[model samples]
Target chain A: MVYFDNAATSFPKPDGVYDSIMKAMKEYGANPGRSGHKLALRLGREIFETRELLAKLFNIKNPMNLIFTFNCTESLNIGIKGILNTGDHVITTSMEHNSVLRPLKVLEKEGIELTIVKGDYAGRINPKDIEKSIKKNTKLIVTTHISNLTGTIMPIEQIGRIARDNGIYYLVDAAQSAGVYHIDVEKLNIDMLAFPGHKGLLGPQGTGGLYIREGIEVKELNQGGTGSISHLLEQPDILPDRYESGTPNGPGIVGLGAGVKYILQEGLDTIRKYEEELTKHFIEEIVKIENVKVYGPLDIKEQGAVVSINIGDEDSSEISYILDENYDIEVRPGLHCVPMAHKTIETFSQGVVRFSFGPFNTHDEIELGIKAIKEISKEL
Target chain B: MVYFDNAATSFPKPDGVYDSIMKAMKEYGANPGRSGHKLALRLGREIFETRELLAKLFNIKNPMNLIFTFNCTESLNIGIKGILNTGDHVITTSMEHNSVLRPLKVLEKEGIELTIVKGDYAGRINPKDIEKSIKKNTKLIVTTHISNLTGTIMPIEQIGRIARDNGIYYLVDAAQSAGVYHIDVEKLNIDMLAFPGHKGLLGPQGTGGLYIREGIEVKELNQGGTGSISHLLEQPDILPDRYESGTPNGPGIVGLGAGVKYILQEGLDTIRKYEEELTKHFIEEIVKIENVKVYGPLDIKEQGAVVSINIGDEDSSEISYILDENYDIEVRPGLHCVPMAHKTIETFSQGVVRFSFGPFNTHDEIELGIKAIKEISKEL
Candidate 1:
């Protein structure tokens, strides 16, 4: 079966990832940082290696500042809620996933001021609009590096520059951009970055992380036994431990480290180029079909591997079902947990069938996808 | 290697658990409950099956009420912080782990009153003490089913009854008691049960759950995409969706299902009886050693598989190190993330070497642990 749901979760992760996870579980599956035994210490050391790999991937200087979370949603919650307090203003764009928008909406009810900069119909967010939305009370600016629904790569470099010049914290939701795109957190002037491991990173699920720049005091969302400062009832005042509470996914993080190692060895740019080729071929051919509407910038230069399309005003779920049942092509359909993004792209009612490509996706699969869309559109 | 660190996380989970996780990852590790494709639907169904299995194990009528979390600490944080608000009081016991205490302590600073009932030297909390601490403003009563540090089994049935009679929510931290002990939530009148999937449940480290009784309204700690009601900005007000956000640990939950399935097939009572035998043998022989001080209610009827001991006032970490390096017996040393429990057992200064047995542990391993303790005590 052809898998096109990389935006949701990457499937068939590299063989090394599976091997590393199995080895970690069978060999030293002990809880890391909780026990002091050899197995526990080994697992702890391996987990730190994962943090280091992620730090290198994101151009983070200190690995200790990076914290592993259950998923990107939890990371976004901690970064958004931990930084902004009551009466503090934050700026974000409409082309973000609910992971960013939902938390901001919740905080908005709790006395935090929020300004949502509107994105164009193609889900493109202008840094100038975001700068105009900023106010004196704006302490933070949040935006997704790439729109999950439209795959429109935002001008985060320009936005980051604006935030840095205005002395505001910039938090980037690199859900779609991480692993498949270049993200130098330091060079981008990003204060915080959240990314999921199971996405483009080719790691197992249950693994994600947040990178906090040095000296940023973000209150932890949940306080618990950090394994350090077990004597104190209060949470530890350490970097990762202050944020990470309880038993982490040990083998999962090992798998994530293996995934990063694979990416580094194979080269992130190489993977991105392959996926871009697939995306470009799929979009170029599919848009030529009759009565088909495609979303996003629809250009390899501005779009990631994700492409959203609707055939003849058909229900996105129905088209997705036909693709799954008739063509054996796996794709996600509907709002994609990004209602505002749907609104931005004018697919709030019709939704869109999202085909997200991974490194493993091939030109052959893209040809098949184009052919299936052409036939389905002609039949409609 | 003899793994006696089950309290931290169960190592070498039943073969089926590993197989199930591997199958889910390699075969159909699609994003569950996110997309409508066959792979996504299959994974979503598998995850729901896990929820059902855990519900059946816990005597929860509605599987929908069970919410999967990263770990028991996240579950406890959600249960404790979600239900209680400002001007509300919470009563907890000293035998509780920091997962329960730390969140309550944080809430205490937020104008929420916290009353920590002291446990006896054996780390046993009197039900009467918990009952007396309840005030008109008492909204919740939190307790651990079994002490992680001392293995003292508290009277949770009695405490649950007290909470029920007092019209307060009862939250049980079943980190130690979940898979082995019997927990009929309905019969015990438990309002909420938080448990670690990695501990006695024998799942991977990333999986844990909170079972909230029907009709109980608890505010979610974090909000994000629930995969249901994607059009609304407000978080979905559903049973599991309200609490579970973002892509879940699909393969991890599948592994947890395999674990609970193993428990069902093997019989929880039989597993508990085997662990009790191991505990009994280890305690009986180790207490006979000179200058060896054992903590907890030594009776298997009143304790769990965990036994904490100190050899001749020697530092617990030193003894633990010797046991690990010399004997290859893996155990947790230090406060065990339950500082108050250590203090209650009067081992606050000279911690304790904790040996927690799992279903897979054998009598031979228990004997080996006893021999190591005796040899260490004699040397001391």
Candidate 2:
């Protein structure tokens, strides 16, 4: 099947990731950092190595600041819930995913003040609006690197500068941009970054991570055995252990390491270029079809490889079903987990069908997908 | 390697568990419950089927009540922190794992009244003592089904009865006993049950679950996009969705379903009997060696397959290393993530080496492990 749902999860992960998971399970699947045995120690080192690789990729100086999580949702929840307290103000954007928006909404009911800056029709958020929303009570400014619904890249670097000037923590949700975008956390002054390993990272599901800059403290989301300081009942005051409290997804993390290795070897710029070519080719052809309207920044350089479109007023789910059953194409429909983004793009009720590209997607697949969409549009 | 660290994580999972994970990853790795494509729908059904199988195993009438977590630690944290409030009282045993004890300790500092009833040297808690500790404000009684450190079984049946009689909620941490032991939550009056799928269930790592009885409400541990109720900002008040946020660990849960299927086909009673025989044979032979002292209840019927022993006061880590390096037998030493249990068994500083048997373990491996320990004991 032609899978266009890379935004949901990148299908057909890089070649070595699956093998790495199987090898880790069979060769050294012992619980890491729990026992004083060779297998446990070896597995523990492997996890640490994965952390180091992530740190290097994100320009993080210390690897211990990266905490493995089940998904980007958990990482965002931890960052949002751990930092914002009662009576504190948080600044976010309309382009944010539900992961960030939902947590902030829950906190809003608990006396925390929330200000959502509106995104433009193209789904891009102005950095000046984020600065204008900031108040003396504002403690944090969080925004997504790229809008999942519109694929419009936000001005996180400029917003990060504003947050630093205001003495507020800056959090960037890189769920859509982690492996494909050139993200230097230090250059952007991002204090916290949350990302899913399965998407652009090309890893399996059940793997994600959060990178917290040093000197920033996020409250422990869940307290339990961290395999460190077991004698003390209190959660240990350590970097990663304080935030991580469980038997981590060992094989998943190992596979993530392999995925990262592949990305590093291929270079992020090269992969980004290939995906951009596919996105540009598809958008350039699909826009010529009658009654087809596309959302997000039209320029490939400004947006990600994700493009949302609608044929007349067709229901997104129904269009997606036809694409899958009749055309052998896999694309996601509806709100894409970002209800607010649909409202910003004027597709709240009639959601747009999304076609997202991955590193492995080719020119031929994009052309065929466009041809199928052209046929579907004619029928509509 | 002869793997005797089943208490940590059962090694060489049931035959079909790994294959199931691979199949799910290749065929149905789409984000379940997130999209409307055929792959997503098929995956969502697979996850629901897994939930149904788990419900049958635990006698849960509604499968929606069970929430899948990254591990048992996350499940215990959700149950512990979700229920207890300030000024409320909670009763737990001294033999509980750190997963339960650590969360309760954090809550204790948050103004919850915590009463840790001491257990005997045999690592068993008396149900009468638990009853004596209950107060009018007592809201919950938490205990581990089997101690990770000593393998002594807690009388959850009597504790459940006491909690019911006192109008208190009873939570059982079945980390080490879920698959091998028959746990009828309804029959035992268990209000909540937390267990790891990777242990006796013989699934891959990164899989575990919590079952909340009908009409019980526990605040969500992590709140984000649950695919359902996406239009609303507030977390949807739905079972499974309410407690489970983030992308469900699809491939890992599929492996867990396969593992549970194997257990159902083989019969829990048969699996339990085989593990019991292994435990008895290992214990009977190990006790015959000079200078070897064992902890926990000596009776096989009253305990699990895990056994903790020491030789002539030698450091447990040293003995475990010798076993792993010289004899190729994998065993866990040190606190085993249960520091309180070690203190209760009088091995606080000098922790005991733990030998936990699995369903695949044979009589020959146990005898060889026992002989290796005996030889090591003679050297000491």
Q: What tens-digit string does per-residue lDDT give for candidate 2 at B114-170?
A: 999999998989999999999999999999999888889889999999999989999
| N/CA/C clash count, model 2 | 0
Clashing residue pairs, candidate 2? none
What's model 2's lDDT at A63? 97
True-structure lDDT of candidate 2: 0.90
- Clashing pairs in model 1? none
Which parts of model 2 have CA positions greater than 4 angstroms off? none
Off by over 4 Å in 1: none
In model 1, what lDDT does residue A187 have? 93
TM for every model, in the order presented, reads 0.99, 0.99
Docking class of 2: medium
Per candidate, chain B TM-score? Answer: 0.99, 0.99
